[model samples]
Target: MSEIALEARNLYKVFGRNPAQAVKRLKAGETRDDVLDVGTAAVIDASFAVQRGEIFVIMGLSGSGKSTIIRMLNGLHDITDGEVTIGGDPITGIPRGRLREIRRDRVSMVFQHFALLPHRTVADNVAYPLELRGVAKADRRARAEEILAMVGLAGWGDKLPSELSGGMQQRVGIARALAADTDILLMDEAFSALDPLIRREMQEQLVELQAKLQKTIVFITHDLNEAMFLGDRIAVMRDGRIVQIGTPEDILTDPANDYVEQFVQDVDRARVLTAGNVMERPRPYVPDTGGPRAALRQMKDAYSSAAYVTDRDRKLMGIVTDRDAVKLVRKGENSLRSILKPVPQSVSQDETLMNLFVPAVESPLPLAVTDEHDRLVGVIPRVTLLAALGPGPNATEEITLPMPPLPHAEIDAALGGAESAHEASANEVPTIKAPANEGEVR
Candidate 1:
């Protein structure tokens, strides 16, 4: 596990002049409403760790105390009770001066509004954080220019915030926070002000940046879809408390409570589901040198008619089918290379299921799930892929009739004879139809 970059230990924040009395009541098992009877209880016993370089999202509807929790993390909101630590230093009740130093050096926040300076040039706005720390003007300017380029605002830095679009202004806000060179980012609805299309664009950019920058981000959002897309793990808040914390798949497939279940019931599974979710442990394969006889025997044992062929390093070479194996054995061929046909379809583990539709439909072979090195990891059979998208308002329930059975009879038995005659043709492992001219899928 990654080292904890930020931790909230029983963190509590009550928002009122007599907050201490409310905290005491809350500690003694009085509810948030009861605490509110005395004074506002904005957060109650919220605790979670933000691991280094992970996007930890806190999400809930309005008034869920998510924003309050983030404020307490950066010491912007006074903690009523419990502790918060940043980079291993206890932050609750720290001296104001020390708290300021931690906020300056270890953490930065991006607010919902762009918060850009209307009159300042983008470069100046981005450099403002560095300027506060007494960085040399030239050094800060250079840093600002570099970060602007990273955010895709390269030559436009000389323009003022008023001259930029909403998305661009948000980028400036992000650039300013990044200029502080902090390890933690507390972004509270930072992209909420943008147009829907632009908000999505900003989200994609943040995802891309996270791939390169690896900063520890605490993203607060009310949109469940946004939370599912951006968060490595999510904390769902309600009534000043966290109700669930889990990965997107975990939250979707196994909701912790009815509230969470209702919250995610409408989520687009295809958008959130990846090839990794549907892929099965690939059946055993043979090296290209494994003769036709051995290949045939293995296929029979596995009740499969086709087998993947790979090199010594497990790099995919091609696929060999029962028909080809039979012909090769008849011809007394020692190696399976002559009969091997190039893999018809493949997907990276992270490819969203939405992107796999065309390939899944067009290919006869199971979709190959390959790693970055083009080495096969597992396979997503058409049956399994269809099953994942089975009967739902958002899914094509009609897919049941067209889905071919899995390659093995054992699987057919397990599936209660969902296997059909159409699937038997999989024995030939139909080759991907190429343009009459080009030879490869790429």
Candidate 2:
């Protein structure tokens, strides 16, 4: 396991003078609604661990206790019960002064609003955290300038926050957080206030920044798409409790319950589902030494019209159809190499399912799913792609990729009246093979 950067253990938050009574009631089989009748339960039994350098997202709808949980992590709000540990040391009930020190030196928060000092210059605002820590002016200024440049605000240090756009101001907020050089960043709806386009830009930039900074980030959001795009692992909260925690694909393909299913119902499956998810185990194939009779038998046994040819090391040679195999045997050809045809189409296993629509529709044969080494991993046939998309918002989009003349009949036949293929099926196809390593489907 990776080193734990932050850990919340059975955390609870009750809003009232008599929180102890509420906690007692909660422990004694009281539902969240029951506690709500007494006072408020912002969070209950919320526990999760964030690995070092991971972007752990806590996401839910309004009043789900996501923001409350983040506040407790940095001691911004008192923890009514339970413990929070940072870097293996318990800080749940640490002294206020010590907690303040840690918050200043080790943790930084980026709010949804760009909390910049209106009177101060951009550099001053970015350097605020370092200033609070008594960092030397020159060093802090240097760091602030560096962070500003990193966030695409280079040479804008002298400007006021009022002079910059909303996106630019948010960049300054991010720069302020980075200026502290904290091991952990607490971001509560950090991009929520920006416009849709700006929000996407900020999300992309944050992803890029995380790659370079490698800071442990605890990000809160109500947006599932944003959570899926940014989080390494996500915890979905509901009614003051985490309903589910899993990777994006995990939550998308296997929702925990009805609630999670509804939560992800409208997600753009095309964006989240990769080639690996849609690819089927290809039918059995043989090395170049296989004769026409042998090749023909393999295809017949696999219920396939064609078979992929590979070397002993699983390096793909080409494809050979049953018709070619029959013709080769009639001509007394012993080896399968001379009859093999070029691959119709191919894509890497990591390619997005969205990107494969054109290729899958255009290819007469299944699109070969290859690895970085160009070794055949699996295949995605037209019917399989159409089956993967089914009939939904993810499937009816106009093709964007340039392609050869499409087979309209084949396209119509695959998707004309099929059931929803949004969910993956375990059926095998032609060209699938066992991968030599991880990430490829078995």
Candidate 3:
């Protein structure tokens, strides 16, 4: 199957009698303002593709046409120009019956309001779509029960919408969409109506559910933070037009224009940047050659006091310091095993920088970055981490440092002080600060 699950091309939505003419004007290099006399352009020449199992968010403030673009995807709003396709099948200009079938079997939508039927049981509300398709009551009811459990409302199937809390009610809304068993999901402000705490919880729940379900989602929102937290890629819309589309880090570090720059100026960079974004190629690693002399030479070549020890397959074994390597050499040790020290800390490639502050500070050497199989992929030096945290146009720029050596005494003292401070306030989060001296190893 192709990777693209949904796509929109040159899409335009106009709300007036002469929408077709307005689109012509737009196509003729005339601005949206030029076509204002003909019709109101809701979405203008918006184009993007949503990969399978990806969360593609459309974000903009009110009247930016984000909502209109989403409606066009599933044929809720007629396209004034361009096309929309789901799973390689065009839905635009299709017969209403065929579109209905597509919506029933391949796409489902969840709205901002719970939209549950007030008089029906939660299970019935969820099973309504299946019921419309003439599914046997017993089968649809069972399916509803199963989906309810997946959304964390297992035993609440018997309760009415009126009897449930607002958050729980929204879960039913999601349950209903999932019960449809569609590969594509369109969520329009789905969590915007909940309380602040409840909204955050729902956002987290959606991410967890997406992991298990792997549904291709088109999430519409006005909140930049939500977009950063949830979207695999985001399309930023302005008045009736898409201005930029990129990953959260791309949007943050390289805004396309002043409008986008202003939008991301207040975003918390720590949460958006992951280890993979800032990590550099791992260097000066000894390939478990079983020789302390080899380890020392590698350290010296990299201008460092320490180096990682990895097996032939690049699976990280441990680290070796120059001092330890020298001791092993003097003691006539042939193997690096005696001198190997367990890496002080390691982080997965996807770990956010916010969670790495303490680990980066505690490590004597650059923090190891590993993949699922524990193979060393890269390293995150303290200097690089500090650079990423600093404010400037180059805040997110990658920095490469020659692995400079730190004296064993200084390394021990820094680690000891960090560990002590960490133990003193286990509940408080540590903040990032620049070192007093640029030459000092972070």
Candidate 4:
């Protein structure tokens, strides 16, 4: 097997009464007849592995055992059966001292409540972890300040936890998690408790932090949007079992079963799949400014897909993939300056991956993403629409991302350079790899 960041094999967690007896009963083929008579099963025979630096999500409705699974990984709760490992060390049988060391040194968790010290300042709550580990107050505070700045709580260091809003308090929680400097981060509905706008903001900040930190994260949530938005691969759970695990697109388009289908029925799929997501390797193409012979050479190279046409500015103008190339050559039009489509349906960097389809289904050629000035960002294959849609969501998914304001001017420029000259927004580099590749897909 690959060297996973974390792994769970035949992991089983049961709550209330004699859990071992419950397991024995379960093994003996006893079934719970009713909710009142039978004890609840928080997690049942769950198994999956997480690769290093990957964001793995466990999602489902309330009481599905997502939280239990997270707790089991961190040693907060014991498993009734099976093994759980972090960086290859089995968590189940470790000594208490060693487990303490592991929790202090390897894993850090953020709860939805943002458990800060109400009496202490933002800086104190962050420093508390390091201090408990016996670091000097000065050293701990220094590290706390660093994390605060990282989580955008720079000036709020002196403010009491009670003084801050829910979003700000959650930020402190995140900063505290980073203070431990652990390889893995465990989030349990970290943003679900906040208001809509605040929750959106926190998710965006988390994305920004993840981009820079790349910590192996196992986040749990009941929100389908958060699961879809932040997960590298989502594990959809139902009644203490993982039903499916794959990229958001995979789960969305090719649902594992009926349960997954109802989950993504209404998602705006184009936003999830972008031209940037489905682009193949770029082949050399004749510039529109190039002469006729160069265009012919380019045409023959393409098996059939339309060849993208660009100007000296690399602004997309037209395509001559496959048959278009043959027809253009037959017409004796040798210059790209003539055959290119002057107007095409294109998306900008600021747009969501869900919009990648408008041009794909409408345009003869594959859709291309352009920058504010109409500079071709990339080409997305039409087939990617299928790839983005993925299997139909049979289970609920979550969406989480940093909240950045849309750039009206940049979008205007992409539509056609119709706006006044102004500063264009800088593209926020993706912190995590998109589902398909490490780079921005759309």
What is the TM-score (0 to 1) of candidate 2? 0.83
What is the TM-score of each predicted model, taking all chains together? 0.85, 0.83, 0.86, 0.71
Give the 10-residue window scoring lowest on summed lDDT in candidate 3.
427-436
lDDT of 4 by residue, 346-386 (tens): 66654666655455566544456676898765545555446
Which pairs of residues clash in candidate 1, taking residues 3 or more apart in a chain or in different chains? none
What's the C-alpha lDDT at position 271 in model 2? Answer: 72
List runs of model 1 lying over 4 Å from the truth. Answer: 284-290, 297-305, 393-442
TM-score of 3: 0.86
Show model 3 residue runs off by greater than 4 Å.
298-305, 392-442
Error of 1 at 68 (Å): 0.7
Model 1's alpha-carbon lDDT is 0.81
Highest lDDT model number: 3
At residue 250, candidate 3 shows an lDDT of 89
Name the candidate that leads on TM-score.
Answer: 3
lDDT of each: 0.81, 0.81, 0.84, 0.71
lDDT tens digits, residues 1-442, model 1? 5799999989888877688898888888999887666688878999999999999999999999999999889988888899998878999766899988999999999999988888899999999999999999999999999999999899988998988888999999999999999999999999888899999999999999999999999999999999999999999999999999999988888899999999998888888878877777655356676666556645655456577888766689987876677677567677898888887778898898889988877655567788789877777666667667646454433223122323554433333454355533332222222222221111
Q: TM-score rank, highest first? A: 3, 1, 2, 4
RMSD of 3: 9.2
